[model samples]
Target: MNRSALTARGTPRRRMSVEQRREQIMDAARDLAVTEGFHAATLERIAQACGITKTLIYQQFGNLSGLLLAMVEREFARAAAGFTAARQRPPQPGQSGFAAGVAGVLEAVDAAPATWRMILLPSQGGPPELYERLDEARRLTREALVADLLAADPALASLTNPDHEAAIALLHAMSEELVRLRLSDPAAFTVERLLAQAEWLAKAMFGRRG
Candidate 1:
């Protein structure tokens, strides 16, 4: 048999390009970390999941910490890019820019449920490093959303820094909870359902009834 079919132990290994190999490794690591918790996603476990050697994984990602960082950064970048694009778009008629930005985020989550779930609903007992990075990403996202809101409606410009911070904190908390609910109980918290609630919240917060 050819080498591709000649493995003695298990499924035959197939050669992959560098990018393909890295993608495989990262995908395996993310699945393990999200389902079983980050600590459970040890080097050996990740390697086994990818049907590759630990050394191979190390070559691609340096170490366990490096792997975790890569996963976080990749996932967070996808999320950040979506929000950034939404914020930069011109407002639709009668639609608050904040609402449009939120719609963009919801659309992204709908498109890539796994990525958002990994970033939003981190596994219990996940690594501190993962949480630290996740928290920072979340903080930045909230700030960007708040900035978009302020830009869209300059009427709220008189608010002090303390008020702005408090408002953003509330918005962040609500968004996080909504994300968790949407993932865990999709039947009850469908995107449309959550977006409707979000619209109400946004209107109440911004006094932008149409």
Candidate 2:
């Protein structure tokens, strides 16, 4: 080939912006962490995954720990945003707010299976920061759910003497289990099926009281 033709062919088709490159690096790291454990998400491996040099990653994120931490923070923020958006949506007509919220959660999981997988079924051997972030996310989710439960069903919240704490714990556990099941076996535990069951359970529990 001619020199100019060779040069043109060798050049990248398009250049990524710094932010785009950072996102690409983070995505590669997240996929590695999800598929092969966090231990596999070293700078060299991430560079290989992104078709970039370790130096580039370092420029973007400072170091291996910085890259991983940034990736985790970005992913957690994404998942949290999804859940927040879902929660903000108004309930469908004739549907209890709780049922609507469950549907929203399933929809979020369906939209981002990889993100949900990392959160719902996190790989072992991750850094302590990862576990701490996960714990904080869980606590925040539980607190939000409790508040939603109280607001959605004033009857329950206004009971003569309700054990709101225990009820909230049970609800949180059930929601977490459902998400885990969906992540583990998506085909077997489809969103529609799970949502139907949740709705049925909710109605069964609250029908007489309503």
Across 46-132, the per-residue lDDT of candidate 1 in tens digits comes to 888877789998788889888878877787788778767756777568766665666677777778787888888788766577678
Candidate 2, 21-55: lDDT as tens digits: 99999999899989998889888899998888999
Against the hidden reference, what TM-scores do the models get? Answer: 0.82, 0.88
RMSD per prediction, one decimal? 3.9, 2.9
User: For model 2, what is the C-alpha lDDT against the true structure?
Assistant: 0.82
CA displacement after TM-score superposition, residue 193 of candidate 1 (Å): 1.0
Global CA lDDT of candidate 1, please?
0.76
TM-score, candidate number 1: 0.82
- Scored by lDDT, the top model is 2
Backbone clashes in each candidate structure, one number apiece?
Answer: 0, 0
Model 2 error, position 186 (Å): 1.2
Worst 10 residues of 2 by lDDT: 1-10
TM-score of 2: 0.88
Candidate 1, residue 86: Cα displacement in angstroms equals: 3.0
